[model samples]
Target: MKKTKSYKFKEVDLVSLRELALKVKNQTGFRLRYGGLLTILRTNVEEKLVHTLVQFYDPSFRCFTFQDFQLVPTLEAYSYLLDSPIAEKTPFTGPGTSLTPLYLLERSNLKTTCQDTLEDILALLIYGLILFPNLDNFVDMNAIEIFHSKNPVPTLLADTYHAIHDRTLKGRGYIFCCVPLLYRWFISHLPSSFHDNSENWSYSQRIMALTPNEVVWLTPAAQCNGHFC
Candidate 1:
C-alpha cells in the first residue's frame, strides 16, 4: 500500500484568535462548548510524524495496526483530550449550508459589539480550521451541523476513522481530520524511554521498535489531569 500525504489546513493568525478567545472565555457556556481547544490549537503538529502514523492505519479494522497491537481513537480519549464533556448522542443530524474561515473572520470583526456572536464565530473557526478540516479555508455544512449539535466528540472520532479509511482505500490522498489531535494522542502513548531519545530516530523507526508492553495505554492527559498543557 502507498503512504498517503498528510494534509494540513492553511495557517491563520491563531495568536489573534487565542487573544479573542480569551476575551470571551468567561462568557456563559463558552468554556464548556470549546473546552481546551485553544490549548490544542497551540500544539506543534509534526506533519511528517502524522503522515508516518497514517501509514499504519488499517481501513478494514478501522484502527492503526502496529506490530502487535491495534489502536483507534475513542470518544472517551477525545473527551479527555479536549477536557470537554461528552454525551451519548448523535451529532450533525440535520442539513446546513457551507461556510468558510473567511466568512467567520469577517463576522468576528464586524460583530465586535456582540459577545455571543464573537464567541460563536470563534467556535466555528476552531471547528472548521482545526477539528474537521476538509478544504482549505472552507468550513462545510458538516462542521456547522456538528457545532450546532453541541456534541463534537462522536463526530470527531467518526471523522478521524472515516478520513483514514477513505485515504487507505484510495491508496494515497490527504487525511482531513484533526491531525494535531491525532498526533498528540499517538505520542502520548509512547514509552518514556522513546521520548528521551526520540530526536535521534525517525518516527517510523521508533514506532516500529516498540512492543505491546512498551506502549502506555493510559496516558496522563487521557486521565483529564491537564497534562495536555
Candidate 2:
C-alpha cells in the first residue's frame, strides 16, 4: 500500500471542491451567498462531478434541467439499477476492451472504499460510456489496476462520489441520484432493449426531448468518430 505524498495530497476532494466553488461562481460575477450554504455546497459538490463528466456530451446535463433530481441515493435504489444477480465481476485486469457498469461495480463490497483497495472499491462507471466510447486497449496497456499509481483519476472519482453519496440523507430511489439520470441519457440514444420494461414513459420522453449532440451521438456509425462532444 503506497502512502506517498500524492496519495496523501487528497487531490480528489480538493479538486472536486475547487470545481464546485468555480461552478457557483461561474458568470454570476460574484458567488451567490445563501443562508443554506452548506446544503447548497453539498449539492454543488455532487452535481459538479456529474456535470463535469457529461456536459460536453449533453446540454441537458450542462443545463441540469431535471426538476426532481436529488444528489443523494439509497443503497436499495442505487443497487436496483447497478447490481446484477448472476453477472461475473471483472477485475481491472480482467479481459475486456470495454468495461460495462455491472462488471465495474460487481466485485466492490461497498462496505467502505479506499484508494488502494481493489478487493473492494467504488467507481463512477458512467465514465466508461460517456467519457470513452471505447477503452479500446485499456486493460492490455496495464493502464488501470486497482491501485492506479500514475493515473488515479478513477479512484479519485469513486472516492469523491462515496464521500458525498454515502453522507447525503437517503433519497427515495435511483431517480434521486445522478447515476440514473446518466443512464437515462445513454439509453435515450440506444435501440429498444431486447428485454424492455417500458415503465418510464415520462422520464424517457424527457431524455429524448433533444439536445445539441443528440443527432450526432445517436448516430451508431458516427459514435467512433468525434461529433464535437
Candidate 3:
C-alpha cells in the first residue's frame, strides 16, 4: 500500500469491523488451544481488570470465555501479578513491545496454540501477499517478508508453511510480525476505526518506531475488570 502524509478516515471502519482483528493481540487466539488458566493482561496500573463480559476469539470453538479456557487474569499487572507470567517473561523482548502478529502470539504460554494460529496467519499472509504485496513489509521478520516474495502465492504459502511448521515443531526460530504495520494495512484496505481508539496503543509502538495503528483492544487490556464465571 501507498503511504501518504495523511490517511483517509472516510474510507475507514475504525469502530466495528476491524477492531477485534486490530486491537486484541494474538494471545486471544492462543487460549483457544490450551484451554487452561489464562491471565487477562494489562500494561499498567491504570488499566481496567477484564475477566468478564468481553470474550476471546478461539479458532476451535469461536469466542469462548474465561471458564471455558480456565484463564487467570492477574489480580494486578506484573508486580501485582501472580505466578510466572510467560507473556511478561519474554527474555528477548519486553511486555509492551510491538512485534509481528506471529511474534505476539509466539510469546503466548500456549505455543502449540500459537503454532496452530500460524497456519491461519499463513493463509492471511498468502491473501495479503498476493493481493497486497505491501503487507510483506509490515511482517515481524525479514525472512517472512522475503518468504512472501520468493515464489507464486500458492507455492510460496505451501513451502513456507511446511518449513516454518517443521521449525516450530523442532524448536527452531521462525518469522514474526509488527502490529502497527498491520494496522496500517487494515486501515488502508479493510474497514477499521483505528482513529476511534488511538490512545490505547501508546507504548505498543515504542520499540518499532512506526506510525501508530488503530487500536480498541486497550479497552479490555487497559479498562475492563477481570471476571471469572
Candidate 4:
C-alpha cells in the first residue's frame, strides 16, 4: 500500500468578518442567499476528527472509503448547508482581473458610499477569505471571479475535492478549503445515538468505531425544504 501523506487543515478566523457580514446581510439579499455560510463559520471544527476522516480518503476514488462504506460530499449537501441556490449557470472559469480590493471598492455604484461600499467590500472579503481562500489574509482574483458569478456551491465542492486530492499527494501541507462546512457535512451523517452517548469518547475513537449500519445514510432534515431539520 502506498503511504498517504500527512496533511494539516487550516481555516481562517472569521469573527471580525462575521460581524461585518451581520451588518450587511440584511442590506443586500445576502442573508437569504448565503446565510448558511455565516452559520457554518460558528461551527467548531474538531481538527482531530477531520484528520482521522482524511485518513480514509481514497485520493484515486475521491471519496472516503471506510472498512464497510464509502462517502463523499455532494452538491445537494453543500447547497443545503449553504442555504444557497445551485446556480444552473456555469461555475467560475477565470483568468481574473488584476484590480486591487480598494479599486474594486471604488467601482461600486451605490449612492450611499459608506453603507453600499461596505457591503460590496464585505462580499468580496467573504469570497476571498471565507468561501474560496487560497491564501491567508488575501483575496485573490479567483475569489473575485466566483463572486461575480453569484454561484458558489459548485466551486465550493470542487475546491474541497481538489484540496483533499492535492494535499493527499503532497505528503505535508494545509487543506485550504472551507473546513467548518465540510466538518458539519461530515458529522451530520453520524447516528444521533453516537452523538448522545459518545461524549466520553474522543471524536476519532467514536468515528473509527462506527459500523456501516450505525451511520445515518440519509439525513432527511438536510434535504427537507432546504432547511436543516
Best by TM-score: 1
Tens digit of lDDT per residue, candidate 2, span 104-187? 443343445332332212222222322112233122223234323223233323433443243322321121223333333334
RMSD of 1: 4.0
Candidate 2 lands at a TM-score of 0.20
Against the true structure, candidate 3 reaches a TM-score of 0.19
* Tens digit of per-residue lDDT, candidate 1, span 1-229: 4444554334555676676677674644776657877667778877777888888988778789888887777777787777677876756665556776777777787834588788878888888778877666688788887877778888888888888788777776667788778887888788889767646988887888899899888676456644422
Arrange candidates by lDDT, descending. Answer: 1, 4, 2, 3
Instruction: For candidate 4, write residues 1-229 as lDDT tens digits.
Output: 5464577876675666666556663633655544565576567787877887887788788898877778888888887787777889878876654445445444443456565566667767767776777755567888888877778889999989999888887766888888777888898888887766436887656766789899877765455646433
What order do candidates take by TM-score, descending?
A: 1, 4, 2, 3
Error of 3 at 5 (Å): 5.3
Tens digits of lDDT, candidate 3, 32-53: 4321112211111111111111
The reply for model 4, stretches above 4 Å from the true place, is 1-5, 22-29, 33-35, 97-116, 196-200, 221-229
TM-score of candidate 1 to 2 decimals: 0.81
lDDT of 1: 0.75
- Better candidate by TM-score, 2 or 4: 4
**Full-model lDDT, candidate 4:** 0.73
Can you give the lDDT of residue 82 in candidate 4? 76
State every prediction's TM-score relative to the real structure: 0.81, 0.20, 0.19, 0.80
| Structural RMSD, model 4 | 4.2
In model 2, the clashing pairs are: none
